[model samples]
Target: MVNAFFLFILAGLAEIGGGYLVWLWLREARPLWYGILGGIILVLYGIIPTLQKFPNFGRTYAAYGGIFIFLAVIWGWGIDKKIPDTYDWIGVAVCMVGVSIMLWAPRH
Candidate 1:
């Protein structure tokens, strides 16, 4: 459970960091060093924890990827001034349902 919490936090931070880079890159920004640094930091944060601790890499990743997509949509609408339409909401719902199944399905 603790690991799951950390994973989600890392995922959100990564999304925010990558989103900042996208915003900067779109503005014809200078000093591109920040982009590389931020990207590496985000990727490392998201990858290291799970790679180091998770027992089932594929299942962990599949579940987190779905949750990441859902959260990205929320962040996009809330912080990026992008309004999500019905299709976006539907996609998020579907992904979240899949995430729940992936994470909770019992193995016998």
Candidate 2:
């Protein structure tokens, strides 16, 4: 569903962005405020998944792992100025298929 995908993307961005900020603070020496804001956003990332309609926590987080990979690739490409190679695209495709199957496949 649209809502589910949106939530996944939102949560992924929160996690990635938050972590990136913290990375900048500690690794790249950006600022202390960067780490503080990143910590707040990380808290939000933890809460966002609870908004999903899926009842199974494991399934939801498992599927989210795939989404997170996809988003991380995009983030790296766009923000880090790292162009993805063919192997990266292949990996993203595989992860996306796995995510779709896990999220949409029928159950007894």
Candidate 3:
């Protein structure tokens, strides 16, 4: 369970960080290397989730969507120095609640 959450965090970082890099390159006029590296990281992001022990692709991805949202807020706050307002925290909380229901709820 710990490992699963760790994987989610790593995968989120790869995707968001990679996208941020590409955003910088194209939108902010950074050098080409940023885009190249971002693309590579995006490719790697495609592969990381497969390492999860969970076998259900849809469930895994659905749960990951929630984790990704939470991580994105943290990433923005730390990297961009943009503090999250009340709505951001509430949204993150809602996302995690949805994730818990999807990933950890008891089922017959």
What's the true lDDT of residue 80 in model 3? 97
Flag regions of model 1 displaced more than 4 Å. 2-6, 48-54
Residue-wise C-alpha lDDT for candidate 1, range 7-96, written one tens digit per residue = 765776676767577567657584677677767767765665564355787877777777778778877888788999999999989988
What residue pairs are clashing in model 1? Answer: none
Summing lDDT over every window of 10 consecutive residues in candidate 1, give the lowest-scoring window. Answer: 45-54
lDDT (10s digit) by residue, model 2, range 1-108: 899999999999999999999999999989899999999999999999999999999999999999999999999999999999999999999999999999999999
- In candidate 2, what residue range of length 10 has the lowest lDDT sum? 1-10
Model 3, TM vs. native:
0.96
Best by TM-score: 2
* Model 1 CA lDDT for position 21: 74
Q: Which candidate is the best by lDDT?
A: 2
In candidate 3, stretches whose alpha carbon ends up further than 4 angstroms from where it belongs are none
**Which rank order by TM-score, best down to worst?**
2, 3, 1
